[model samples]
Target chain A: DVKVTQSSRYLVKRTGEKVFLECVQDMDHENMFWYRQDPGLGLRLIYFSYDVKMKEKGDIPEGYSVSREKKERFSLILESASTNQTSMYLCASRTGGIVNTEAFFGQGTRLTVV
Target chain B: AQSVTQLDSQVPVFEEAPVELRCNYSSSVSVYLFWYVQYPNQGLQLLLKYLSGSTLVKGINGFEAEFNKSQTSFHLRKPSVHISDTAEYFCAVTPSGNTPLVFGKGTRLSVIA
Candidate 1:
């Protein structure tokens, strides 16, 4: 089965601290995405990468950034963590191109900024 | 750009009863629709997707959804539900060949004994 692995399942960071959440997919998928899931809001995409070294901002990309240095690895970064940034982060990957396909998701990382 | 709207925020029903979760979308172009379920404190799982062809799509765990092009809606349904069916269901859409999928606010299903 295809596997998407997230680096952490739960994390706590102090305000103003830089934080990183990592993800890796073994399916060799070319597209990787980072989304923040909150109660009532569901899942909101923060950023998505169609290829290595290429990224695009999603609707709610205000306080988050992402990096895809390698094909299998995509990383989400919080330059300065804040209380409002506390939420469950999810990583997903899908095949390349615009073909209709469902994304495989990780177990998710729940972050709390204190 | 594409947007999805889940008409109901929460639906409660007794076990063995039929249920339907309504979803609608607005987009200028043709799109792909999907229904995902997220159990408590877990990642989202694909329940079903409607890309093309038949409007009635059957998914895992005895769930199915119908894609109505005229109404621009994809509603998930099940003839009979179980206690294990309790989860948050999200409706998503992306313009055919789009990057990110736009998601709805989600509908929480509560199964009563």
Candidate 2:
């Protein structure tokens, strides 16, 4: 089984604070993703990295950025946390197979910004 | 661009009752379809995926879905549902390559005693 480990399960931050959510995959997958889960809007991708030091913006990447300094680790950075950014964060990774590879997900981190 | 739409926001059914969750997608290129179930506060788990081959795809926990090309729909179904099946179901799609999946709003399944 593949393992995607998240740095924290729950976090509380004040408004205007910078936050970092780290993720690491042991399977050496080539693709890593960060997503935010809200009540009505299932899971929306914030950022994704296909290789080391390579990142792409997803549909909702306005206030978020990502860093992939290594192949096994991807990080999501919230430049300035706000109350609206409080939600569940998920990390997923997939291999670079020719066909579509199923993404394996982390347990998710519930973030609360007050 | 690819997008997925789950028709029902919530579906209520009694134990052992049949249920269906409708999903539709819009994509200009050939895509891959997937059904994922999230239990309570847990993360999403893959229930089934339609890459190609048969139109009817069987998945874990006695769930299955059929792919309709003309309708551009992939609807999940189960003959008899259990209380454990109550969860949030999401439909997602992506192009036929290594890319991120576009997810729908999700349908909440509530099973009564």
Candidate 3:
């Protein structure tokens, strides 16, 4: 089965702390995405990487950065954690070079910034 | 740019009853549409997708969606829903490119026993 794995399921961080959320995909997909899901906001894209070392800012990219050093791993970093950043972070991967494809998502990491 | 709008925030239905989740999208060019389901404490799963060809697309768990070009809607429907079908459904759209997907807020389906 295709799989996308997240490093942590739950995390708690103090304010102003640097936070990192790791995601790895076994499907070897070229496109990787990070989204923060809120109660009513659904999933707001934070950042996405279509190729190694290539990234694009999404609608809500402030206060967040992403790294795609390798093909299988993608990371989301919070420069300074804040209470407002407490939300469920989801990582997704999809095949590139085509428009007709669906995304495969990791279980998700619920991050709480205190 | 593409955007999706889910009409209902929540829908309550008795078990074995039909349900429909409305989704509308706006885009200048042709787009790819998808419906995803997210269970409690889980990530989203693709329930169905509409890339092209036939407007009527059938998906897993007896769920189907019809793409209406004139109306700019892709509404999901199930003949009879079970308790297991209770989950949050999301509608997403991406234009004909390698861009990211834009999602709707979501519709939470509550199946009453």
Give the range of the ten consecutive residues with the poorest summed lDDT in model 3 chain A: A94-103
> Candidate 3: which docking quality band?
medium
Over 4 Å off, model 3: none
Using DockQ as the yardstick, the better of models 2 and 3 is 3
C-alpha lDDT score of every prediction, in listed order: 0.92, 0.93, 0.95
lDDT of 1 by residue, B5-101 (tens): 9999999999999999999999999888999999988888999999899999999999999999999999999999999999999999987544778
lDDT (10s digit) by residue, model 1, range A3-79: 99999999999999999999999998988999999888878999999999999988799988888889999999999
TM for every model, in the order presented, reads 0.98, 0.97, 0.98
Ranking of predictions according to lDDT: 3, 2, 1
Return the TM-score for chain B, candidate 3: 0.98
DockQ of 3: 0.76
Task: Provide the fnat value for model 1, as a fraction from 0 to 1.
Answer: 0.64
Q: Which stretches of candidate 2 lie over 4 Å from their true place?
A: none
lDDT of 1: 0.92
Preferred candidate (lDDT higher): 1 or 3: 3
What is the per-residue lDDT of model 2 for residues A1-114, given as tens digits with 9 covering 90 to 100? 779999999999999999999999999999999999998988999999999999999989999989999999999999999999999999999887676867888989999999
Pairs that clash in candidate 2? none
Least accurate 10 contiguous residues by lDDT in model 1 chain B: B93-102
